[model samples]
Each structure stands twice: as structure tokens, then as C-alpha cells.
Target: MTPPDQPPPLEPAELSAYFALIEVSSLLRHTIEQQLREAGDLSYVQFQLLATLGDAADGSRRMTELADGVVYSRSGLTYQVGLLEQAGLVARAPSAEDDRGVTVTVTEAGRDVLARVFPGHIEVLRELFLEPLSGADVRTLDRVLGVVRDHMRAVPPRSARSRRKGAARRRPAVDDA
Candidate 1:
């Protein structure tokens, strides 16, 4: 019998799968980071922010929404958005729907940066991440990860805590680390 507070250990195969996922993720991100830096002079988080906003139909999202979408801390996202705002890439404005909400919009400059960066981003993904995977493997991986992502998101991690009613518009304390 196990202690009530003690969780079961991962089986060997589970451990292997977890480590492989971590290592592959690290390798892919390293290459993607280099590409984004060189092509758009943007960090991975910045590119994610810009791309997310660029894809938004209204070309804008509330700061809390961006934090959820990118799985980033509110403070970190704020700093990145500040940098983009300073670069004339994105603009922050009062949300029309909620007076207390701040919406972030990708400026034309941000769109231009995404356009410049996307080709190399796709290439890096293809070369370092996707090239070795078969179509069946890709499909299985996508389906599995989608399920995993959904399961994780359902729990409302720290970044997703803004989804709570009164918390939605409240400024989060810095937890960037």
C-alpha cells in the first residue's frame, strides 16, 4: 500500500515518453527562437503575442486573453507587450466592452513583422520538428497533444486564473519567474 499523500511513480515507458517530449520541445524551441530573433528581431513570446493578435479577427485581444492564449504570466506578457508597443508594433487601448480591460492590437508594423518572420518559422518547424514524423505519427501526436492540452487547460492554471469573474479585469501581481 502507498501513503495517501504519495503519488505512484511513472512507469519506465511513461518516463521515457516524458523525457523525449521535454528534449524535443527544447530542441525545437531553440531553433525556432533563433529564427524569430534573426527574421523579426523578436523573442518567442513576442512572436506568439503578435501572431495571436494578427490572427484575431478584430486584430486585438484583451491582455488577459493574450495571457491565456500564450500560456504566459500576465506580468511577463505585459512587459513583452510594452516592448512591442515601444517598437510601434502593437498598441494598447481601452477595451470598448469593459472599461477596466486593456485591449492589445497588432499594429500594421506587427503584421509586417509576422509576415517577415513566418516563412522562416515554418521552415524551422519543418526542418527541426516535423521532417522526421510520418503523416500517421503527426496525426497521432496532434490528437494526443490536443487532448492533453484540453485537459490541462480545463484546470485553469495560474495564467488562466484571469478567467475568473472579478479577476478578469484585476491587474495581476508580478509572477514573471
Candidate 2:
């Protein structure tokens, strides 16, 4: 019989899947962090910010938008952005439409860093994440993860918005191209 105060344990298959997911996530993050640090002297968050900015059509995003996208606290995002600014990898400016807002844009230096780091990043991803999966497995993984992500986004914690005021930032920086 189970203890009155304790919840029932996971089933064997559930336990195995849960542990496997945790282990894979941890291992992948650690490996990627090491590679990123060596290649670009970037923290995982910094790499994420840079990569997110790189993918933006304008190569920029509002501060609050970035905070949401990166799943960071507004204050934490501010600090990270400050670090990037100091490194000349990103710039921040007031939004023209909304003076209260701020926009962050990647710099030429940022692009150069991405260019330098991406090849190795891709290789590591291929080796550690993609090579083991068949095409069908990849598709199934993507679909399953997408569903989970969407569900989580609809709930609390992940759905929580920053309490920071005036985070309605503006347009991206001048295109580096």
C-alpha cells in the first residue's frame, strides 16, 4: 500500500521516459554550453539571444518580446542585454513609436560571432542530436515537442508575463547587411 501523504509513483514506462528526457536535456545543454563557450565566449543565454535576434526578419526585437521569447525575467534580460551591449554584440535604443519602450538589435560584431560559431554549433547538433534520429523519428519528435510546448505556454509559470513596466520596446537596429 502507498503512504497516505505521498502520491503514487510513476509507472515503469513513464519513469523511463521521464528520466530519459531529463538526462538528454541536461547532457545536450551541457555539451552545447561547452561548445558555445569555447567558440564564442558566450553563455547559453547569450547564445540564445544572439540566435533569436539573428532569426528575426529585422534582426531585432522589443525588450519585452525578447524576455518572453527567451523565457527570462525582464530584469535578467536587461542584465544580459547590458552584457551584450558591452561586448558590442548588440545595441539598445528607445522606440520611436513608444518612448517608453526599447528595442534591441544585433551588431556587425554579433553577426561575425554567429558566423564563426554556427558551423561548429551545427556540427555538434548534428552529431549529438540529429544523427541518431531517423527522418521519421525527427518528425515525431518535433510534433510531440510542439504539442507539449503549446500546452505549457497555455498554463502558468511558462505563461507568466513579466511585471516590468514600459517594456513595450520598438524597431530593430539598422540592418548590418
Candidate 3:
């Protein structure tokens, strides 16, 4: 008999799928990170930040938006943005909509960096991640991943954590027996 507190074990196929997803993600990320570093001297997170801002219609987004879009902690995003600002790759300005808000814009140099690295980035993705799949397989994978992404994103992102009520209080530490 199973204990009530213990959840049912994963089915074999479920376990295999989860492992494959994780391994593929790790492998793809490692290659992409290397390409970003070598081609643009940018870390993956930094590249994500720049790409997100570059895609914006106005080429600017609020700090919180960037944090949410990049799925990064606000503190970490702030530090990366600071580094980019120091490098003259991006600029921060007060948001016109809200006095307390900050807007970050990708500079021409940032755009230039994106342009330089994007070809190699796409190539790495194609060769390592996409090339093995057929057209139908690619479409099915895209659809499945999109649904998973949407399901996961349904939860409020890390950027919203600080704004939640009672989030200011630290949780009591747990004692391990």
C-alpha cells in the first residue's frame, strides 16, 4: 500500500520524456552560450536582454518587463543591465508613464552586437537543435513546446514576486530531522 503523502511514481514514458527534454535543453544552452560569448562577448542572459529590447517596437522596455520577459530575477537583471549600460550597449532612462519606473533601450552598439552574433546563433541552433528534425516533426515540437511554455507561464513570473502581498516577509526556515 502507498502512503497518502507519497505521490504516484512517474510512468516510464513520462520519465524518459522529462530526461530528454532536460538533456536537450542543457546541450542547446551550452552551445548557444559559447556562441554568444565568443561572437559578442555577451552572456546568454545578456543576449536575451538585448534581444528582448531590440524586438520591442520602440526598442525600449521597462525594467520589470525585461525581468519578466527574460524570466530572470529583478536583482540579476538589474546587474546585467548595469553592465550593459557601462559598456554603452544599452541606456536607461526614467519611464514617462511612471516616475518610479525605468526604461531600458538597446543602443546602436547593442543592435550591432545582435546583428553580428545572430547568424552564428541561428546556425548553432539549426545544427545542434533543429537540423535532425523533419518539417512535420519541427512543427509538432514547436506546438508541443509552445503549449508547455504557455502552461508554465500561466504562473506569475519572478518579477511579480516582490509585488505580491506578504512577499516582504521571509519564510521561516525548515528543520531537517
Candidate 4:
């Protein structure tokens, strides 16, 4: 028998998986944040911005692109980038391609910081995240999460008017016959 007014609930296995994901995400972030702060005197967002710029082909990205890549608000990213600029870890300049846009690039100093922080960061990741998973488990997790990410990205958030508008803006144009 079921209660008429109540909505269907997740099965136990589904609930367990959901909660585990949430808990693991929170715990991992906390650990990583502490490690970053202690090792590099860097906040997670600052580290993320530096890392993202470091990985770019030109070691630079447009402010809008960086904002989307880091899941940060444009204004917040501007403030963070300002701090990085002040620290001499990054530089900002008017975009040559778009007069209205700004490009952010990591400095030699930023790379130095990354080099200093990387060893410890890797150790933390290996200890907290990788050690518990077998090779097969790692592979499976990667594949599963990739699918989930693609699905989620394809579907706009509830606040958005439609997936088409949001997803289209995020992805490059493609022609289909």
C-alpha cells in the first residue's frame, strides 16, 4: 500500500548512491581546499583559474570563457582575477580579437606557484581519491561521470528558459543535413 499524497521516492540503492556522491564531493572539496590553502596560500577558485590558464594552448583565455569554464560568475571572476593580477600571478589585457573583451593569462610566477603546489596536490588526490579505487573502478567512474556530465550539460537548469538557448550558446555551431 502507498500513501496517496506522497510522491514516489528513490529506491534504497539510488538514495545511497546519491548521498554518497554528495558526501564524497563535499569531503573531497574540503580536503583539497585545506591542502591548497596550506601548501600554496591559494583559494580553490584562484588555483582553478591559474590551472585553467596554465592548460590553455596560449596560457590565456577570454574572461567570459574562463568564467564558464570555472563555473564562476563573471563579476566574481573579475574580482579574483584582479587579486591574481595584483599578486603578479596573472595578467589581464584587452582582447585583440574582441575590443569589448578581456583576456587573462598566467604569468611565469603563476606557473611557478603551480609547480610548487602540484606535488602536494597530486599526493592529496592520490591519497584521498585514487587509493580507494581499483583501476577498473576508476575507468568505470570516468565513463559514468562523463556520460552524466554530457547529459546534464545538454539539459539546461530549471531556471533557464530552454535547453536549446543555453546549450547552443555553450557549444559551437554544427551543420546537419
In the predicted model 3, the residue pairs found to clash are none
Q: Candidate 3, residues 1-177: lDDT per residue as tens digits?
A: 668999988899999999999999999999999999999999999999999999999999999899778777677888999999999999999999999999999999999999999999999999998899999999999999999889877665655557667775432221000
TM-scores, in order shown?
Answer: 0.88, 0.83, 0.90, 0.83
Give the TM-score comparing model 3 with the true structure, all chains together. Answer: 0.90
Model 2: what TM-score? Answer: 0.83
How well does model 3 score by local distance difference test? 0.88
What are the per-model C-alpha RMSD values against the true structure? 4.1, 7.6, 4.6, 6.6
lDDT of 2 by residue, 127-167 (tens): 99999999999999999999987875553332243435644
Measured with C-alpha atoms, the lDDT of residue 77 in candidate 4 is 85
Top of the candidates by TM-score: 3
Q: Candidate 2: how many backbone clashes?
A: 1
**Model 2 lDDT, residue 91, Cα:** 95
Worst 10 residues of 4 by lDDT: 168-177
Residue-wise C-alpha lDDT for candidate 4, range 104-145, written one tens digit per residue: 999999999999888999998899999999999999999999
Candidate 1 or 4, higher TM-score? 1
Q: Which ten residues in a row have the lowest lDDT in candidate 1?
A: 168-177
